[model samples]
Target: MADLRVELCGVSLKNPVIPASGTFGFGREYNEIYDIARLGAVATKGLTLLPRPGNPVPRIAESRGVILNAVGLQNPGVESFIKNDLEWLRSKTKVIANVAGSTIAEYGEICARLDGLVDFIELNISCPNVKCGGMAFGVRPESIREVTAEAKKNCPHTPLIVKLSPNAESIPLNARAAEEGGADCLSLVNTFTGLAIDIERRRPILANNTGGVSGAGIKPIAVRMVYEAARAVKIPVVGMGGIACAEDAVEFLTAGAAAVQVGTANFGDTRACLKIIEGLNEWCDRHGVSKVSDLTGTLVPNA
Candidate 1:
């Protein structure tokens, strides 16, 4: 058997498979299906300083190979998470608190509150900056840096991970910017902006009109972007996009992700992360790889 352990930003993960935020929903429902402790870590849904009702209904839509969502970061707020879910989740496995904010100050405040309470603070900078005319903080490298810095400053005791937005103008530049802002780790690519039309009504399928696209259809593009971001940064990168199986996880690791997060795959099969973990063990042994950590950046490019 091969060793599946891998370290992300000095934090040890038994494996490199974490359930992505939003998709896993604090791992409570999934825990009823399987032992979530068997996995690497669980990233909580995007938490804000206060609770949000999220976007209107019909926020989720389905296409052939992917799904679209404009859920709008609905959550019970950071205090609620800390008071209710935090301790229980930490008892099972590493807890990565995914946080978002409407302003840079709010990011700092939330991070300060969650400082040493969680193993890591994953910043979801994709939220619109209400103070800045509703521009997403992750859209620009400058804002990515600013928000990352603010969050990092407040969470000095915990590792700060800047989750990159795929919809940004320059992923590599943004990755570097996050690094420059003192991000201990990084995760990407959040979701690609896409629209689904309901031809029957000649209108949009999702009530939000457009939604973030995710699923198996995004693996190739995500892999390429992960490779680019990883190559451009010294900090560890957590790759996620449309990973559904173990092979998909391996592709991200080899492409330069120190860890991989399973997202939409969780919706298809509740045990997707576990199955991927099992598949990885079998794959490593079959390939004669001793440690899974050795798989990072192992991709051989065609010259």
Candidate 2:
């Protein structure tokens, strides 16, 4: 057997498989189906200081190999999570609290509240900074640095993982920006901005008009972007976009992801993360590798 354990920002994970935020939902519902403790970590749904009802119906739409979503960061709020789900989730595995907000102060406030409470705090930079005319904080390198710095100042205890948006002008530049802002770690390629249309009705499919695109179809592009981001930064990168199987994850590892998060796969299979974990063990054994960490940045490119 091979050693599957890996470390992220000084924290030990049994493996490199963490379920991405938005898809896992705090790991409660899935815990009923499988032992979610098998995962390296569970990134909770995007949390805010207050609960959000989310976008209107038609929030989720399906297509070929990808899906579009504009769920609007719906959640039960930070206080509700601490009071109800925190303990139970902590009992299972390491917790990665994913947080979002409408302003830098809101991000700082929420980070302060979660400090020392979870193993890691992942700043979701996708949310719009309302004060900036509703422009998302993750679109440019400047905003990424600003929001990450603000959040890190408030989270003196827990390590801050800035989750980068894929819709940026330059991913590597943004990755470097997050690093310069004092981010302990980084996770990316958050869903890409995409549009799906109802041809017959001549209307947008999702109520929000446009949605974040994710799934197997985006894996190739995601892999390339992950490679770009990982190569440009000294900080560890948690690559996530359209991973569905172990092989897909191995590609990310080869491209230089220290860890990988499984997202859309969970919506289809309850035990997708576990299955990928098992597959990682087998692949490592077959490759005569000792530790899975050895596979990071192992890809050999042709001249």
Candidate 3:
């Protein structure tokens, strides 16, 4: 059998397949279906310094091969998360606490609180669902650097993973900016800004007007961005967009991602991450690959 263990920013993952944030929640719901510990790590839902009710109704809309959401960052506050879910979740698998904030100060405050608690603190600077502070800090390289630096300053102990926005002017530049600002790892591309309209109603489907589009449809764009960012930065990159299968994950690994996060697909299949993990093991074995980490950056450039 092939070794699926992988190292990201010095932390070891039993496998490279992680259930992306927002989608995985606290891993409690999915734990009933399968042992959540089987996962490389569980990224919690986007948490704020205070609890949020999120955006208005009609937050999720379905289209072909994709879904658009503006669910805001609705969640039980950071303190609540720590008091309620932290320890139980840690017993299952690694925890990547996905956190969001409306300002740099807020980002720092939350990071400071989670400093030595979680295995990793994933900065949700690219969430398009929230109107404030989410994608705002992720649009420009300067903000990306500044916010990341602030978050890193507060989170000196825990590994910080800055989630980059796909809507940025240059994904590579933003990624490099995060690295320069002290991000231990980078993850992209967060959902693309998209609009879905109702013809008869002549109005936007989502209450937030625009939402983040994610699903199988965004894989190619995500892969290209991941490759570009990976090549540009020396830090580990966690690639994700539309990964529902083993072959999909293989593409991201070959593109130079230290690991891949499985999002949207989880809504359609509860065992998506497990299936992909099994598939990766089988695929690697058939290809004579001894370890899955060997798959990273193995793409043929000229081909």
Highest TM-score model number: 3
Q: Runs in model 2 with CA error above 4 Å?
A: 127-135
lDDT of each: 0.91, 0.89, 0.94
Evaluate residue 179 in candidate 3 and report its C-alpha lDDT on the 0 to 100 scale: 96
> What does candidate 1's lDDT look like per residue over 58-142, in tens digits?
9899999999988888899999999999999999999999998878999899999999999999998864312231237888888
Candidates in order, TM-scores: namely: 0.97, 0.97, 0.99
How well does candidate 2 score on lDDT at residue 48? 89
Better of 1 and 3 by lDDT: 3
The order of the candidates by lDDT, greatest first, is 3, 1, 2
TM-score for candidate 2, residues paired by index: 0.97
True-vs-predicted CA distance for residue 207, candidate 2, Å: 0.9
Model 2: residue 236 alpha-carbon error in angstroms: 0.4
What lDDT tens digits, residue by residue, belong to model 3 across residues 1-303? Answer: 899999987889999999998898898999999999999998899999999998999999999999999989889999999999999999988899999999999999999999999999999999987767999999899999999999999999999999999998888889899999999999998899999999899999999999999999999999999999999999999999999999999999999999999999999999999999999999999999999999999888995
Alpha carbon lDDT at 174, candidate 3: 93
* Model 1 score (lDDT): 0.91
Q: Model 2 clash pairs? A: none
Model 3, position 78, has a per-residue lDDT of 96
Put down candidate 2 lDDT per residue, 238-269, tens digits, no spaces.
99888999999999999999999999999999
